[model samples]
Target: METILEVLKKMEKATAREMAARMKIDAPDALAMLRDHEDRGEVNQVNGYWQLTGRASKKPANAVPKKTKPPASKINEAVLVKLLHEHGAMTSEQLAKLADTTVRTVASTLAMPVNKGRIVREKRGNVFHFNVVSKTALGASKLPESASKPAIPVTETPKTASIPEKTETPAPQSSTAFVDTIPQLVSTNGQPAALTPKIIAGEIRKTKSRLVQLEKLRVTVRTQTRLQRSLGL
Candidate 1:
C-alpha cells in the first residue's frame, strides 16, 4: 500500500478522483482516507487540491526554514525592561536610537517603569532626569529637616465672638397658597425648571446615543491604530 506521505510527495496538487486513481483505490475510499489525513493536519486543501501541510513537511534530512524575528516594536515590554536594566538608565531618545524604534515607543517603555515606582524623576531646569529610586530612599521620609533650626511648639489662637448667630426662621405660609406657591417655570419663559422630566428623559436618550457613538468611535480608533502600527507609522 502507498503511504499518505508517498502519495503527497508524488502529487503537489491533485483532486480526490485524481489522487484515488493514482493510489489505485476506489474514489470514495480514497477521499475518505484523504479527509482523515487532512483532519489529522497531515494535509491541507489549497484551491480545491490536497497538499502536504507544514506540520507534515518535517523529514529526517530536510532542513526547516528558520522563523524571522518580529520587529523591535513587537518585542515584549518585559524583555525591553530587562534589556534597559542591563544597559542602565538612558534617555528616551537614546533608548529609541539603540532599539531602532521611535521615541514614542521608548517613552511608553519608560512610562511603565515610572508608573510602577521602579524609577524616579528629577527636574533640573527644563530637563527631566530619571534614576532608579533606591529601596532605602523610597522608604525614607521625603521631607528634609533644617540642621540649624530648633523645634517650635505650635500655638492655638483664642476665639472671640462679639456677634451672636442669627437663626433663620421659615417664611410664614400664605393661607390661600396652593402647590407651595412656587410658580412652575416653563421653557417659553426662558426657565427650564418645568421641563426637568423632559430634560432628564432627553439626557437619558442622548446618553444611550452617545454610548453607541462612543463604541463605534472606539472600534474606529482601534482599527486606525492597528492600521497605523502595521504601516509602521
Candidate 2:
C-alpha cells in the first residue's frame, strides 16, 4: 500500500475515497489513518479533502494591526521625595504637573500609609502641601522660638518710629461710630450706599476726609468677622 503522505505528495490533496483508491485500501481505513495523522499535527482537512500539514494554506496577515494604549506616567517614590526636598513643599497639583502625571496618582501616593514616616503634610491657607520629613527639625521645638525671638527685636524700633500707629488708635473709635451711622445714612437717603470706587470718589470729593475713616471701618468689620468665626459665635 502507498503511504498517505506519498499519495498526498503525488496528488497535492486527496479525499479519503481517492486516497483508498490510490493506496488499495478501504475508504474507512484511509479516513481513520488520516484522522490519526490530523491528531498528530501532521495533516489537516478542509472541505472533505485531506492535505499534509505543510501544504495547508497559511492564514492571511492582518492589514490593520491591533491598537495598544500608551503606557501611564509613573512617579517613583524616591523621585517624588526628591522633588519635595528640592522644591521645599508642593501641593499635589504642583507635584503632578512636575512629574507629568495625574493629580489623583500623586494624591494616592501621598495618602498611602507606608509613606507616613517619609513625608509630612501641612495645611497652608486652603490647600495641603506635601514635604519631605525633616529628621533634624522633628525634635527641634526651640527652632521656632529662636526664629521668633529675632523678629521681636527687629520689629521693635520700626514699630516705635511708625507714625501710622499713633494715627490709627483713634481710627477704631471713629470707625465704630461710622458703622452705626451707615444704617442712618441708608435710611436718610432711602437707599443703601453704593461702595463702588466711582461712588467713593464722588463722596470723597464731597466729604474729603471720610474715605480714610471708611477704610478703617472696613478693616474693623473684617477683624470683627474673623474674631466671631474664631469664637464660633
TM, every model: 0.26, 0.29
Which pairs of residues have clashing backbones in candidate 2?
none
Q: What is the C-alpha lDDT of each candidate?
A: 0.61, 0.68
Q: What tens-digit string does per-residue lDDT give for candidate 2 at 1-233?
A: 35677888799888989987876656655776576556556788988888987988775696564353343376667778888878988998899889887665566455432233567878999998888867776556446676646554445433223123334344345744664455633535555554567865665576657777898997898779766766799
Give candidate 1's whole-model lDDT.
0.61
Clashes of 1: 0
lDDT of 1 by residue, 1-233 (tens): 56555777787778878876776655655665566555445676777788878634455666685454333453335655655567765565666676776554455445545655777656667766556666677665344666336778899864433344477997877633432343443344544354466865776787799899999997898779766766799
All candidates: CA RMSD (Å): 29.3, 29.3
lDDT at residue 159 of model 1 (Cα atoms):
40
Stretches of candidate 1 exceeding 4 Å from the true structure: 1-72, 75-88, 139-233
TM match of model 2 to true structure: 0.29
